[model samples]
Target: MFRKWESPEAVFHLLKACSKGMPCDITGIDDYRMIDEKRGIQWPLPDGHPIEPLSERRLFEDGQFYTPDQRARFVFEAPRPLPEPTTSAYPLTLLTGRGTSSQWHTQTRTGKSYVLRKLHPNVPYVEVSPKDAAELGIRANEWVIVRSQRGQVKARVFVSHVVQPGQVFMPMHDAATNQLTFAAFDPYSRQPSYKACAVRIEPAPVGRSNHSALPALNLFIASLGE
Candidate 1:
C-alpha cells in the first residue's frame, strides 16, 4: 500500500519502464547500508553519481520523456462520478483525509500518550461552509452531526470559506468520523476516495434539562402558586 506521506509516482513510473523492456542500471551494490545511503539518489545521473543524496532534479529537464511525440499520454481516467453526487437525500458531500502529521487511521492508539495527543488534540477539525453553518444555526467550533449514506458521527464544526458551499472536510484521524464515511474503493487503483463523498450535517441535538436552570426558590414559589 502507498503511504500517505510517500509519493507513489516514482515507483509506478519505474515499474512501467521495466515492463516495456527498458533496462535499469544498478552499480552492483545491494546491501541495506547502500540502499539507505542511496535513498536521495536520482535516476539517469551521469556516471551514476547523484548530485545530491536526495535528487532534487526534475524530470524532463531536456524536454523529452522517451516518447516519439514528446508528449505524455492521457491514457485513462477512472470515472469517479463524484461520490454521493446528487445528495438529494443527503444534501451535502464529505471529504476526509490526513495532514502532514498524525500517524494512523485512528487516534485511539495515538491518543493514549499525553504528549502525542496534546501535540495535536482534536486538530484538523471538521470544516463546513459559512452558509451551511448559518442555515443550521451553528457557530464555528460548535458540534454538528455529519451523516453519510453509511452512517453518522458528531464533530465540531469549523466554518470557513475553504469549505465549499455544500462540501465538508474531516481528517480521517478520528475513528468516530470514519463511522459516517463512505468506504468505496477505486476499481483500478484499489484506492478509496476518502475525499469527495456524499454526506449531510446538522446541528446535533443538545441534551440539557429545561428546568435545570431554575433556582430552588423559583421552583418552590411556582409550586405554592400551583
Candidate 2:
C-alpha cells in the first residue's frame, strides 16, 4: 500500500521548483511563508521583494501580453455545430452549472457542511419548465430519468420557470450529471463543451426513490460531528 507523506509541507518543498516560469511567482518555499505574514499576496513577487498592501491588483495594466508581439491577440472563427444535436429521441437541450454559492464543484468538501447542504437541495434534481413537465406527465419531486447519447441518470423533477421550454438545467455537483455530457472540446482552447447536450426526460418507474447515497452518507457524517 502507498504511504502518506508526513505533512503537506513536506510535499510542497519537494515540488517547489516546479512553480518556476509559471504566471505566479510562488517559486520558492519562502514565498509560501509570506502567506502568514501578508495574509496572501498575488503572485509575480520575486525573492527579496517587499509585500504590497492587501488590495486588489490587476495585471497587464499596460495592455501587454506574454506573446512575442507583447500585445493581446484574438482568434475569430466561423461558428461550429454542437457535438450532439437534439433529435426525436432526445428532444431537449441540457445545461449544467453551479447549484449554489455555498456549494462548490463535486461537493466533496462543501457537502460536509450542514449549513451549506441545508442552503441547497439535498438530492440531485433537474429543473424542467412547467410546459415540458406537464407534457411529459412528470410531477414535482417525482423521480425522472434523463438520458443522453452518452449515458443517463435518475433525478428528481423540479418544475420551475427558471428553465425555458425544450431545455433543462442540472447542477454540476452530482457525479451522474457529467455522465451525459459530451466530451467534444473547442479546437482553439481545448476546453470541453460541457454547457450543451441533447437529452430526453421520462418519469422513473413507480416506487423508485430519488435519494442518492453520497448525500445521505454526507448528512450522516455531518450529524456525527454535531
Candidate 3:
C-alpha cells in the first residue's frame, strides 16, 4: 500500500519514469533523502547529466534549437475582443485579482495562519473609483452588492482613485467573487478567462451583515483576538 503512486515518494519515482527521455528528466532525485539533507535537485538531470542544486545550467548553451530546421520559431495572432464587454446594464468592468501579498487563491491554507490573517481584511471589500462611488451614491465602507449576468457578491465600498471610472476591482480570495466572473475560456488552452467581467454596483441595504459568503471566516478572525 505504501508503494502506491498516492504516496509522495512514489509519485516522484513515477514522474522520473515518465520523463526518462525528456529534457525535464529528474532521475537524480532519491526518495525522501533530498528533504532530510535540505538539498534540491534541478531537473534534466538525465541519469548521467552532472549538475548541482542552485548551480548555473543553460538549456541551449550550444546555440541550437529544437525546431526541425534547428532554428528558433515565433508565432503571432491578432488580438481578440473581450467576450463580456461592459454595457448600459452592467456599466463597469469588474476586474478580479489578488488583493494583497497575504491573500491567495481561495485562502485555503493562508487563512489558517493568524499572522497572515491579520495582514489582510477579514471582510470582503471592493475597490471602486471615486468617480463611480460618487455617481452610484456609495459611501466608504458602506455595504454594496456587485451584480453580473452570472450572479452577485456583497462587498464594502473602498473608494479610491486606483481604479478608473468605468472599472472596479475585487479580490479573488473570496469564493463568492467567482460567481460574478465571466465564464469564458481560451479555445486552444482551455484555460479559464475570468479575469474580467461586466458588473454593476449598488449600495446594499442598510442592515446587510459584514460577512459575504464565508461567515466562518469572520468567526475564525474573531478567535484570533482571544
For lDDT, candidate 1 versus 3, the one ahead is: 3
Model 2 stretches with alpha carbons more than 4 Å out: 1-4, 28-33, 54-57, 62-64, 68-70, 211-226
Question: Each candidate's lDDT (Cα)?
Answer: 0.61, 0.77, 0.77
- lDDT string for model 1 (1-226, tens) is 3353255545544443444423233333333355567663444433334455433766677666657797655558865487558457788777777732634567767768676554455533577788988887888655567777778786666666777887778878876666776677876568876677777777777655322323432332233224
In the range 49-79, model 3's lDDT, one tens digit per residue, is 6655568777767666767786766657589
Lowest summed-lDDT stretch of 10 residues in model 1? 216-225
lDDT of 3 at 204: 79
How many clashes does each candidate structure show, in the order listed?
A: 2, 0, 0
lDDT by residue (tens digit), candidate 2, 53-170: 7666567776878788988879999988888889999999999998668789889999899888776655677889999999999887678899998899988777777789999999
* Candidate with the larger TM-score of 1 and 3: 3
Best by TM-score: 2
lDDT score at residue 81, model 1, on the 0-100 scale: 80
Which residue pairs in model 2 clash with each other? none
Between candidates 2 and 3, the TM-score winner:
2
**Distance from true location, Cα of 54 in model 2, Å:** 5.4
The TM-scores of all predictions, comma-separated, are: 0.55, 0.81, 0.76
The order by descending TM-score is: 2, 3, 1
